[model samples]
Target chain A: MKRKPSIVVVASSGGHLTQAMCATSLVKRDLVLVSNKNMLDGSHFTRVYTIRDTQYNVLIHAVNFFVALKILLKERPRAMFSTGGPICLPFALAAKITRTRFVFLDTMSRVTELSNSGKIIKKYGLYDSFLCQWEAVANDSGAEYHGQAFDLGDHGHQ
Target chain B: MVKPLILVTMGTNDYPFTRLYNAIKNDSLYTDNRCEWFIQTGSCEAPVAPACGVIEKIIPRADMEDLIRRSALVISHCGIGTLNLMLKYRKRVIFVPRVAAHDEFSDDHQLQIAREIKNQRMKVVFPDDQFPLLDYEQIKEDNKLSDPVDITNYDLAEIINQKLTG
Candidate 1:
């Protein structure tokens, strides 16, 4: 049987990881999930990799950049999909350099504006396509206004 | 089950949300009403008193999900992750936000999210707001449990499906 195209699903821990999982659960093909250590329960994915959490440290961030690059090189996935976060940036960049298509899904928290991560992706044209959960964010950031990642279980919690 | 499990989580945010932790710890109702308490304290130091099951570090996703599934009520810091999980499980939630003034969070975004949760099925509890914790008799008298709100099934999933497939 022919191998299905795999998309790399990447994010930071907590909300970013959760949003990525919820959104990527929709993908029909295989998925390669990556995030910071213990940030996700990856039993659902065929492959899962954990990167260390280094949000503010410049040196560690640089090291993890290569770590992300390594993962992308190994996976060579068809597409890289991410919910915006610091950790996902490296993978997105590696994917960009490799000419792998990248999709950036802005998390639902930034209702009125684009998050810091989202802005960086939009400003640099890092993603092949950028999607926003809220229409206002899409309007302000010029990312395409896709529906929210949280709507499947939004439960009016906002 | 000796008592309904009331799970309290401050999320896995590195900063300890002492406000939520203290609120539940000091409140007499959770114990007085015989609600067995389990708290995922994360980085927050668990209370020495009130003797509850505590998780001080990040837990695996499945373990977290199982706790949520078993809980009768969930009291949480207004994290999108915790809220999303509660919504997915359709559990009754008491949403509490870490406040900037209290130095609980770097920003007041959680407060904004908590306000929105007020319009939903969950009850929003602000730091200074006077809410009687676990007034079981009053809840039963008011018959509040019968109406189940379907807060899931918004258009986000469809949009993602379309974006990926089409």
Candidate 2:
């Protein structure tokens, strides 16, 4: 029996999470989501885990690392996708050790310099593909442009 | 007759323009009791003077749409979130980019966004090193100079959808 590839989507709250959700709709595989914010309400996930919001404090990062390690062992996802933030750190590190494919999408906010998170993950060489919203960011980061970068769009009243 | 209200948002990220808050708190421009100021701070600790003639309220993560709907002018940081919200709402806006040297961020990318907005002839403000005190009336008048470019979310959705499906 051919097993469907397992996929894990991870991001911080707000824009990153929103961007990841956009990608989730197109993925037709076993899916899991991990985030630091309670932004996920009524989300479709095989499992959902909340990690400490890493906007402040390093202790949260240490805790999330262990949590990610445990999740990696249990699900053994084939690929990991992230929109760049502290929450993606643990998963990126775990993917490196497990030899799983890791994809990093630099947020649209950075048109020139790599985001702080992007810079940190760049050294790992674990990222199989680095996706960027702007061509300049891809050129500057030395990552192959994945193309078709999306901006969050004009704010529409819900 | 009531004056049109002006909404000011600095977004969730704290910028180094704390001085702007202090400058407008007790300014004579707001003393006329004609112009109303609706300001949202990124932090609860933002030092705000008591309401003199204009109303001041501290809203933590308030709805951007509500703020824009009730406002005639929007003063905001050069962040994309705020910029997109203003454009989405079709409100006349003035943007002030935070300087990187002031520790606003690790880089000065906001300046790049600001330049892009300027190239489009959108209303934007880039403070000189001196952080010159701005006249509210002048800022309000400058907003009428340009027509905002229509940047829609449909394009964004289509692009992401293609990437994910492809």
Candidate 3:
């Protein structure tokens, strides 16, 4: 049987992964995750690939770049998405190299600016569609604005 | 009567948030027996045990979710993940942003996100601010079990979906 094409998601373990999950919640395609930590109980993705976590470390990024190449070639995702920490750097590079449609959401944590990884991605034109959760950041960086992964207002209190 | 659960999550970041650990450790409730504590310290060292609860470096995400559902109060780093979970469970939370000045995180972005938390159920503790006293009475009142509500912004998700599948 032929397998469905998947979307490869690259995010770090905590906030980035959370935002990635919420931002991708409506996606119906098979989802494959590339993250630094395996915190989940196996509920969210069709497959989870663990990669070394880093922050502008050239050596580690070098190692992860090849790993990213291998994963993308094997999974051959229809598209790729990320909410980032520096770990997403290699995957972003890989997605660009593979001609995968890459959509990136700069993490909601960065209220005033894009993350370091997001900055590099933007500067290098690594993404096909780049978005920011904060409108201010989007305006400053010329990235698309989509409210946020979840509501952060007073509307839901009991 | 069962002791109300107080949950502390320092997030899954590699950074060690000993400031948060010390803050909770110094709280009068840390040694009190009125309620129990469950702390997920992540990369932080578990130097000692609490008088009334368990301390683990980290637990699986499912375990964390179950704990959130049963928790009376949550003290967490201002990671978007913990914030999202608390919102889904509608849990009362005290959020402490991890600051780069203190080496609690890589940057001051947590503080930025902390500013966006307008939820009545959530409280933000700035670097200079005190970690508010844990109210046993308030905790006891809030101890009822709950199920998580779907809190994802489907409108945003729908937009993301369009951009990706297109």
Candidate 4:
């Protein structure tokens, strides 16, 4: 049997997590999800890991980084996907070191400026493919704009 | 007198009105007796009310859907959830983007969403811009406005399936 590509979806709580979940419906492979405490529940993931809600602190970030490394080691995911925020940082680094494909889907917001998370990812150039919601943002950030994957016109309940 | 209930939400994270709450309260626009204003403070500290026509209600996140449904008009921050709810319910929305200058966030995604709303011909309010606070009659007029897009017709699962598998 052909081996399926393993994927890990990472994000912070709330909108970023929601956007990640919405995007994950497209992947047809083994998946593991990691997010902050707030998004741990009411999610569809075979394996879920919760991290502390640390927006921008080095101490909290270091802990999350190690935790992510541990998870990545155990899961052996072929690709990592994240919407944005601090949680994605460690995984993106691990993906680079492990030669795993890191796909950073810039969250769909803020047309004028790149998100802080997007800026960090761009600075490190860790993303194998940086997906964006709008072409203008992608062009400005020098990332690949995949356009909005979410069917915003669709209001059907999930 | 029966007054139309105006629902205002500034989203889950961004609270641009936190500092401006006091300024708004003192303004005659909010203090004038015309309609009842019901504001939802997602996670921010509640604003002190000025003696006027406004009534503040701090709603938990769980109650957002119910309140949106019952409201005659929704004045909300430019968040995906807020936009989705307004689109889904086909409700009249006067959206205001949260600005970074207000310490809302490090970036300005809300402003982008607001721009998109305006492009769609939907009613929206920009932050730092003056707005004639909607009265009961205006709220009704706003609801009668049509949104250019019908979000219900598109299939989200199909889109996701195509993107992931192909």
User: How high is each candidate's TM-score?
Assistant: 0.86, 0.69, 0.97, 0.73
| Candidate 4, superposed: residue stretches over 4 Å from native | A1-6, A28-32, A37-48, A98-100, A151-158, B1-5, B14-16, B19-39, B47-63, B119-121, B138-166
Per-residue lDDT of model 1, residues A1-158, tens digit only: 98876778887777787787777766777788887765454554778888877556777678877987888888878788888667776676787888888888887766677777778788888888888887876887788875766653445433
Off by over 4 Å in 2: A1-9, A13-50, A53-58, A70-79, A97-101, A146-158, B1-3, B14-16, B26-32, B49-62, B119-121, B129-166
Q: List the residue pairs that clash in candidate 1.
A: none
Binned by DockQ into CAPRI classes (incorrect, acceptable, medium, high), candidate 1 is acceptable
Pick by TM-score: 2 or 3, better one:
3
DockQ rank, highest first? 3, 1, 4, 2
Per residue, candidate 3 scores C-alpha lDDT tens digits across A3-37 of: 76899999998778889999999899889999998
Off by over 4 Å in 1: A39-42, A152-158, B30-33, B118-120, B138-166
TM-score quality measure for candidate 3: 0.97
lDDT of each: 0.71, 0.62, 0.90, 0.65
Which residue pairs come into collision in candidate 3?
none
lDDT of 2: 0.62
TM-score of chain A of each: 0.88, 0.85, 0.96, 0.87
- Tell me how far the alpha carbon of residue A26 in candidate 1 is from the true structure, in angstroms, after superposition: 2.3
As for lDDT, the candidate ahead, 2 or 3, is: 3
Across B10-125, the per-residue lDDT of candidate 4 in tens digits comes to 65453446643543454464654555567766555655643333344344434566666666677766777667667656676667666788787655777877777632424666
Model 4 steric clash total: 4
